[model samples]
Target: MNARVEALIEQARGMTSEERVAALDALQELVAPPDQAWGEAWARESEERLDAYLRGDIEGEDFDVVMERMRQEFLVK
Candidate 1:
């Protein structure tokens, strides 16, 4: 890690368990990618599926069919 992050970690290490947990949680969340990014990615994928359907490369229900098949074939009971 870089010097600033190392310093912050050292400061957190000197705190009580609750304080350390709070500081670490704050730092982790600040560095974490947003859930919206995944949502947008899935939206793009859904658009691609719709396009493929329109182009006649696949059927209209292809997305749902693939999902149902995966659920039946791979998902555990």
Candidate 2:
């Protein structure tokens, strides 16, 4: 590794766990920033889904039932 990265790693070692996690998150954002357009699309989709649910145009499933079904499909041998 380069000297700058080695220095940064050494500094990170001195940080608290939460501080290290914050630093890691900052580094990841620098490496690959989020897509603003995709985020906006998801926000619009979520709002539309919520409106449908509120209008009773779509029914919601129970959380526990969904989890049990997922476990049976994915975890059962």
Write one digit per residue (lDDT tens) for candidate 1, span 8-52: 878877899999888777877799945898989999999999999
Each candidate structure's TM-score, on Cα atoms with residue i matched to residue i, is: 0.37, 0.61
* Cα lDDT, model 2, residue 72: 93
The best candidate by lDDT is 2
Model 1 CA lDDT for position 72: 100
Q: State the TM-score for model 2.
A: 0.61
Q: Which clashing pairs does model 2 show?
A: none
Candidate 1 residue pairs that clash: none
